[model samples]
Target: MSSLSPTSPPPAQSHALLSYPSPSILLVTLNRPLAMNALPFQAHWDLSELWSWFDDSPTLLVAILTGAGSAFCAGQDLKEVQANRLQPPSQPYLKGRPPSGFGGMSQRKGRKPIIAAVNGVAFGGGFEMCLNCDIVIASPRAQFALPEARRGLYASAGGLPRLVHGAGIQIASEIALTGRSISAEEGIRWLFVNRISKSQETLLEEAITLGREIARLSPDAVIATRGGLRDAHEMAGLEETWARTKERYEKKLYGAPNMLEGLAAFMGKREPKWVVSNL
Candidate 1:
């Protein structure tokens, strides 16, 4: 697969940093460390495009999202919002908003898995992004919250629904209503976090390691598993659900090229050269 060289291009002003840290893993770091990586309007647009690029890029198999410096993200930029409101652009629709939802990944159906490496505070939209990720790795000092209610704002970026589904109705309600912060430990207890790193520096490391593990497997199998898990939640009837799951496996996994590669790799004691295919 092709890779991005260090000299390819400098970081875009709208982005903190976007780089390929590994062969198949892309690291998207929220760069505004000084302002806690707040998502200004431009940042949102950048994220929207970035997510689409990752989804279409054949070389990139997985991505790890994190924040620069100490904090993960402080949510939206209130100042930017206020300024935009004051300006009141003549063409409101042209103001550039992410169609994929806030931070690009929330409230949308995407195939590839994203891992949120939460290093510090993940508030408001930040927390919502964490909820949208396929996996979440948090630092011991990380804090998660949806403080929108306190500010007389609501979490409209799939935060409410994702939180409810990921953390349960009760816990989600408590977090949404109170607008208080929860520590990483509490997040683990609520099953929101997949793993806890000892420190902020290790958060991305852990996430990349996990992403690499996923990348090593058949991309088709990973996509199938992800799709099945997503579909499993909305399904009810046990027999029908099992049958559907089996059907997907038969169509997507069984007799697929990747399936043959996986079996051959195991038997031959060599890494399989897998191909990307929905079939």
Candidate 2:
């Protein structure tokens, strides 16, 4: 069942809304509809801390990040930043802290998978956050862009690396250089978006359903699988990557309780009860 957090309440309704919509799924919503769910200073800090909470929570196995109202997110609150500073606020990256970038997930290194439910305009940091997700589901009306170039700024919140990694260097360069918004169809064509929903409401529903399905898997196996995939992506040599994948499977996934449970369940024609743990 869905439940909102009351003990660790967010700053304001305009900042964000955190809720547990299922047994193991966390739904994070950027709540500033009037501001297109822009990330103000407090919102940024809250998101940073919220990721930590999700990491520690044994109940939360998946996260669905989305925005309220018509827009997914319009990136930073420019008006709020302009009122206090001459330039955009500094990246939230600290010298020694958990690696959570803009909106708390961009540069984060963790096992839990996050799915971006892009309901509307996702510009600059918002687009960066979408890139940070393991999967992205966007509405037909949703648009994405790294418009920092147009504003004489740069995407410093893991946008460059994530974009280049997902969309290739050439497309990443063009998007960053032109600051042009990509339609949901174009995003799908470019392989940036996993799928496009008919509308925002359907987008969230699909994302939640997806998150629930993922949450049902063995948590430790999921963690190991995600880490192994990331390592393979970063490895240069094919032989070395294969060796590493084999080693990871043997050490982390193979012969584990979860693996045995799966085999037993299949043989017995029953559902497996997985023990959740992080390796």
Best TM-score goes to which candidate? Answer: 1
Q: How many residue-pair clashes does candidate 2 contain?
A: 0
Writing each residue's lDDT as its tens digit, candidate 2 over 200-268 gives 668888998898788878777777777777777667788898788677666767777878888899899
Per-residue alpha-carbon lDDT of candidate 1 for residues 172-229, written as tens digits (9 for 90 to 100): 9999999999999999999889889977667778888898898887877877787777
Q: Where is model 2 poorest over a 10-residue stretch in terms of lDDT?
A: 1-10
TM-score of 2: 0.86
Off by over 4 Å in 1: 1-13, 94-96, 234-249
Tell me the RMSD of model 2 versus the true structure.
Answer: 4.0
> Judged by lDDT, which candidate is best?
1
What residue runs in model 2 are displaced by over 4 Å at the alpha carbon? 1-14, 86-99, 240-249
